[model samples]
Target chain A: MTTAEVSAPTTEKPKRDKPMGTETRVAWTFIAPGAALLLLFIVAPFVLAIWFSLTNQRLISPLPTRFVGFENYLGELADPLFWKSLWNNFRFAAFVVPAQTAFALLLAVFVNQRIAGRVIFRTIYFTPITVVMAAAATIWVLLFNVNGLVNGFFELITFGNFAPDWLNDPTWAMWAIIVVSIWQGVGFQMVILLAALQDVPGELYEAASIDGAGAWKQFTNITVPGIRNALIFVFTVTTILAMRLFDQPTLMPRSPGGPLDSTRTTMVHMVDLGFGRQAIGRGSAIAVIFFVIVLILTLIQRRFLKEESAQ
Target chain B: MTADSDVRVSAKKSVGANPLWRWVLYSVMIVLAAFFLFPLVYMVASSLIPDDQVLAKSQSFEAFVPTPFVGLENFSDAIERANLPRVFANSVIISGLIVSLGLVVNSLFGYALARLRFPGRKLLVGVVVALIIIPFEALAVPLLFMGAQVGWLDTYQIQILPFIASPLFIFLFYTFFLSIPRSLEEAAMIDGASPVEIFTRVVAPLAKPAYATVAILGFLFSWGQFLWPSIVTRGVDVRPLPVGIGVFATTPPVSWGDIMAYTVLMTLPLLVIFLIFQRQFVQGVASSGVKG
Candidate 1:
């Protein structure tokens, strides 16, 4: 059957080699709608982003737009709020990526065990990922209230000494967002890592145990290397998501990027400028710069993954 | 034996072999589960009670339980005050359009890229793959500009159209189509089936998993979409549920019970779908993670 299947396609290779006939026409016709949308939405907008960044454009301005090359970029860099927003993006990714990754791996490992009701446990763990971020933020805003459940728990645990206003206090506001982000995001990474964990051959664990390897040692030597690609993938994806933080911060805080701008991510900043302030040129510059930062981070991650795999 | 001990015995060869260690693990898991579940449970509980009682009960364990139950008044109030029924309809229409239209367009594009011998097929695939890395947030400003320029802003098409032809979904369908055996298509060709017919009959049926993955992901994405909709949509006319609920939550004279009710109303549909299709949801997410 395998030989027959292999030969069948090759047997018709002569007829398939003809260029730009009905096949090409049919293919292009099939592809036209999606291709047009992609070009219009993605490609053209990307090109316009660069062009708009170099001009003095406003969402609604009386003055005609003109070329002001790199001024927008320079002005954005000079602004302290832009730096604060960029730092917040980095700060968010810095905490969320590692913390969420570790928690997810822990949950994955726990659910990967042969314990009964592990499926139930996994389903419960992954429930948050299915909840819309806006709803999740709304749910959490109540919990993060001054006299809310979280503070109630803290008061109980700390004997009534340490309950802070979570979303209002500048010191605690970013941490509140970070905690909510991790709580909401960890399940997604856990699900992926759990799949990867299942793919790691059972024999490897059995073999390691037979060789008298301890659990931690087996994890580092066997399990880590086994799911290395997945680990890196989860890390990179989580980092990208953390950098793109918008919805939670937008919805959870007293205002979008409020509590003295404690959680103003770059995406939130770009939106605030482009739409809220109507500074389209500056917003476009921020968008372009943000894209470059994410692109650079992704490239760096790819190179790092490549080097690690090469070794 | 209790279910816990049954789990312990069944998992003997597993890491939780020793009873003491098993107890510890179970304890930790129970704590974690409570931590994960308490907020959601509290939201539901709060949604069922009066607005005043929600904050009053927060300091005690009673917060997790519905007390002085006002029944579904909060939900009704949420619907009335937030104009939720219209927002709900808007969300359903927008997400439905995106998911349905996306499946057809992306799947067709993917199928062509996978099977057809076209002039720029390789280049198109590469471009799609490259496009996947460009986050939508980066393009939102320019897209907004373009939307405003062409008067596409504050319209359903602005939200639905930009997202319908996703590079990631296209690539997902492309890869899935590639994995279908060549012999099946060859046989269909021998039977005098056109490319379109072959896709509809032979190929699409086999690609149900791919379609399900895309549909679920697309619906979830479109339904939960916050930034883009919040940008383009200025009125409740075309505003989806997430942004509606968000604006409702932030508006003054806040009622925790009503907000929770709104949130539950926003979240319940997806949660029900998720529970029913939990395995597919997990597998879809996992496969996307692994492949992408």
Candidate 2:
């Protein structure tokens, strides 16, 4: 065939390619309902929240609302409770992210093996994650009760009458919530890591074994680098989850912030201010601030992980 | 066959000498598994004990043994006392509606992103990625206000409406749809099938795995939802299981056995579904790959 024959076929295909067609319209039709729902439920509310945050709003009021320029933001910034909860949130994140990520990775490495009963072990490890929120919280509440299982265990280990109210004592409540959070969240991190671990090529391990590398050497040089992307993913997710801490404290605490606001995470504080105290503007400001903090932390995390990967 | 023969020879020669290493491996795994399993065993053990004995150190571990096993009395009392049945029904309705709506909505939005030629498509994607980071806590107050304005507070509408469309689900579906080879759809179109018919018959069926992933995740999030429902549903009239269980914590004369029974009840449906989709669920999550 001549060069012209081949070039003619390509030109003909371009000419005959059906005109921008009905598929596009059909796609929009199928997509509109969901798009519209998101606009109403999510996008619209977000805009309304910004507006509400700028005004002195009340849940039950017919009074004319007036805009106050940055007053709510300033007020929340100055408020001791707001700052305290913000600090507590940092502490919660500091403890949870490292603890859960390390523990999950350790568990995954041990269990991702060709061993007997591994399936059963995996299921047993992941079962607490499936426990519904309320049930899990209640069980923990019982476990942390002044004379609860934890105290009982502590007493038995100490060989004496040694019981401190795990949830009630101000010093211990936040730690109690952190412990349960790790228990509930580590399963998710483990599954992600395990899946990544399994994806590493078996040939790489065999190659390392041929070089007389022990398991520890092989893990550091091969497995860690192989699953580095997954490590970043799990770390980011756990950090996000830790920052969004709410339900654990709200459920476990005797009050909104048990024992002197020790367990009062920022999310819980925002809810308490907005709903419990009926300060919608203050609550919205807190939420907006909360969003900003999370955005900054996430950006910092991404940059740090990128640098780590580059190194 | 070569490696098998070699491994057999090596295994017979080395088995006796590796006893310490084998014990170490098994012991480490056993300890690690126990760490993960401890809380659950404690939860079950605590739940079976009498209310007084639940918090009392006087009772030994023997008290928690299932010997004089209490019948389903704990479950019935928990159901009545915590008003669990109503909450369970509410949870079912809310989660079911969200899952159904999410499947339809996400598939549609995903298809649009995959194939449509709409303006600002890139911009919309950007908005969604940003929104994923804006924690749900940030949206709670605004959603609550929006729901109240529409006369949806204290109703199932408030519980189900805010979550009907998940950005995470949309992102997953969009990626899945994009991966599908275009030839299949092109062939359908050439055969004179309309876009709607082609999509329903070709694209939709091929996207089953994606749909299943979206459904299970949507259901889990809605089922596990706590804060939004609590904020919107002020009364017991429309509260779901999580809220019901939260209220259970504050009630006087709380029953440990019944509370455990309630916990068991709450976890049953989700556990069944997770087990059923265990393989697919794992694949789906892993394939999403580095997403929130």
Candidate 3:
């Protein structure tokens, strides 16, 4: 065909492409209910929260509610427990996020193999994903209790030489939270990574093996890069979740903070401040700050991920 | 030739194929599996043991083994003392309403964003998508303030209404619906069906996977939730299972076995439902790439 004939087919098709002919009236009607809910629940609460964070509001006190102009924010910064929980929150996230990511990635690699009982193993590992945080928290509390199965196993392995109070001891309480979190959380990321792994071509591995790359080398080079999007997604999510870590720590502590505030997390501190003391202003301030952290962390992760993909 | 190849396949499948490596992988998985199960298995085994036995074994890994003696005292006490039945029913009702209503509302919104052209459609989609990352804790205080002002507190509507149209669920449905061909909706339009009719009869039915995903994820989320219910509701009238379990921690005469028993009772229903529809759950969560 002539060049004009070939170009004509592509050029003319754009004009004939059907218009997206949806009616706006019907569309508005369809979105109305959900839009209303989002407005009332998500948006309204978010706006109100920022407003409340500036006030001296109490849940049921006779004190008149009035704006305090970031006093809650300043007050929280000075409060030792607030700062302690902030560090504790960061410490918890730092410990759990990388551990869970590495653990899940390793698991995804193993189960991604054409191994025996993969189905059974996947199911077994994923049981915790279905568990309520409250339920998982209860079980872990028992296991971490002095002389419970957790310590018993430690002692058994050490020939009766070691056992620590996993829950009550400040030194071990944070680690207990970390370990159970890894247990409860790994299955989720593993499942995501496993799906990501399936998208990697078998031929890539074959080519690497033929080129004399060892399993670890092939994994680092091929598998990791292939699932880069998923890795970022999982890591970012795990971090955000770790920041808000509650339920597990909440159940472990006799008080809001695990003995001496060891296992206290940011959101848990916010909850204690907000509901326990009915200090709505400070609690709202804490939440708003944490929300900013989550927002920034998520955006940075997305940017980093985009750069990786762009590379 | 077929029989010979089948024999080779069986050999490859067996632990004998690569005996050493196979053994290592198997042992690793088994060990890992046992580690994963340790908390839950311990819970069940500990719950079966008498409170005294559980306490006695609390310091040992031997605590994992159900005692030489066992009884249902924990289960009975949990049922009686904690008012387990009431909370369980309350949780079921709340989860049920949220899941069922949630599917309809979210799917409708998702459908609009996916298939329709409207004024501010892009803006609305942006709003929903943006709200997805704002954790409920961030919203709780103000939501409480809002709920109390509207007299929604101490009621099921307070919990149900706020969550019924989850931004994430809408996004999930939107993703699923976006992949659906416009031709299908067009065909229904040509048949003179109204938009809602086209949605309900044509669009919704074809989106079975989306529905299943939304249902399972919604159920798990609504059930697993502690923060919101803990914030909104008080007294036994509207308390969910998790909150029910939590309140006992502060109350006097706390019994560990009873707590474990309640945990088991609270957890078993969800586990069973999840297992029954696990494929849908996994597939739903897989594409969403985030746990509810």
Candidate 4:
């Protein structure tokens, strides 16, 4: 059956009242600006990048460009640094995604309660979300200083015997980046999860409590199950963010890469290739490959993390 | 339900629970809250200090407090050195242009899909969904090359055009329009209004909140951009505040106090907008389902 017959004489009829020619023309006219901009920005750039990835487009040159199909990919494949940087991205994602999720969920749960100063608490947690990464990076450098608040916390608990230069120490730098990433990142995810958590029925918790369930049990069995979609959404977004791994690492250190190239992410590497070293073709190749990896990672995450089981 | 109502239930339940437990929860929450607030506190504190005492050992209990108060020299100096006013002007212009143009393109596309029927409508919706996942990082390189090819480098259009429409923004409008009743538009049409007139006068007026959400979102995006502008802008001439700050922070003779002042200056307007429209901001983020 046609759409008109199947869905006859409702609000849908008004839209179909016009002749096909007029409707189509109106649709095109309405869509023209967005379509044109999308084409110019998204589609054309995507096609251009694919073509550039196949060729040798030096950032600067008297040298003419040539199509070196698969050469760039092969070179990237053989480069150990490429692998290391990609692994760095993976390491970042692995650490950040779960940590961010757990902390965000905790914050959301806490603020979701009947508590004094809940608005104040909510705003405090969310305040960091307002911070620009550049400002965040600058602020964090002091926090990691030997005599900074990190060590201040240490002194309050211990003797402050071991204060390390966080951004400069290769051993501590990645951890430092992870710390900063979580702090700035968690607030946003918390807000999302909070919005989801609010949608869940409070009566379920009350009923579970009446059945002699503890808070932990209720959280695990009820709250977790209730906000399962939001959990996936938060987790997926966090993972994708980790894969990108740009601004936090870029800004956290005395320089862009952190100490001893320990925090040099795939994004930094891409920037180094495209802008720093002026090898546009190699960078384009990296970007495409990076996109594929993210796509694959997202698929794997969805397969494993989907809420189908919850249903 | 709000926390007030939730808390009432918990308070009743806690009548039989331990009294100390509630105190402990509040303490932990307060400490963690302070931890999250530290950087913002530190930025403002540092900015209020004299340049000499900014990074120096002070007589205060904490590292953030300075011994002497500086009378906004840092703010003045930072503005002069970074030419922050000019960069702020650039940011305002860029964000303004992006929001104004973005609303036009995205809203039109949304109105078409939500209200009009044509061939390829489903396919176009699919395209938007697919495009939404294409992160700007992945597209950065090719876009840069395209910018160079088209001689758009160091131009305002380079910053403005690439961000004029996004699938998420279109979806936001599309969803909003779908929620709007169709009979209103039909009545408008029967009153001899054109379809375009129905959209602008009839539909768009009712969609003011949607426009505000998109506008605030669009403004935040264009203003807060760092990496893209870093790539595309050639130098001080076209660089917005964040990019200019990124570059400035890297260069030598970087004064901590001045940097903090710049941070405060750059951050306050956004913070104010956020505070004033926190509800709309939350709606924007939730509806778009993207990170800030």
TM-score of each: 0.94, 0.90, 0.91, 0.92
lDDT tens digits by residue: candidate 3, B111-223:
98887764456666667778888988898877777777778888988978888989999999998898888898889889998888999899999999899988987887899
Across A1-311, the per-residue lDDT of candidate 2 in tens digits comes to: 34443354345444445543444456567778887887887778777778878988766568877799799998988889888898888898888888888888887876676556777777766766777666677777877777666766787888856677778888889988888888777877887898888777666767777788877887899889888878888887788777788888888888877779998888888899888877787788888887788888779777867787688
* Each model's fraction of native contacts: 0.69, 0.51, 0.60, 0.46
Residue-wise C-alpha lDDT for candidate 1, range A234-287, written one tens digit per residue: 999998898899998888887899889998889889999999999899999999
lDDT of 4 by residue, B154-234 (tens): 989999889998988898888889998889998997898877888889999999988998997788667878789988897
Candidate 3 error regions (>4 Å): A1-22, A309-311, B1-17, B59-62, B68-71, B250-254, B290-292
Error of 2 at A173 (Å): 0.9
DockQ of the two-chain complex in candidate 1: 0.51
Name the lDDT value of residue B6 in candidate 4: 77
Candidate 2 docking band: acceptable
**Model 1: CA > 4 A from native:** A1-20, A308-311, B1-14, B246-252
What is the Å distance of residue A90 in model 1 from its true position? 1.4
Please give me the DockQ of candidate 3 compared with the native complex: 0.45
- Report the Cα lDDT for residue B290, model 1: 75
Docking class of 4: acceptable
User: Docking quality tier of candidate 3?
Assistant: acceptable
Candidates 1 and 2 compared: the better one by TM-score is 1
Interface RMSD of 2: 6.6
**lDDT per model vs. reference:** 0.87, 0.76, 0.81, 0.80
Clashing pairs in 4: A114-B7
DockQ scores of the candidates: 0.51, 0.44, 0.45, 0.47
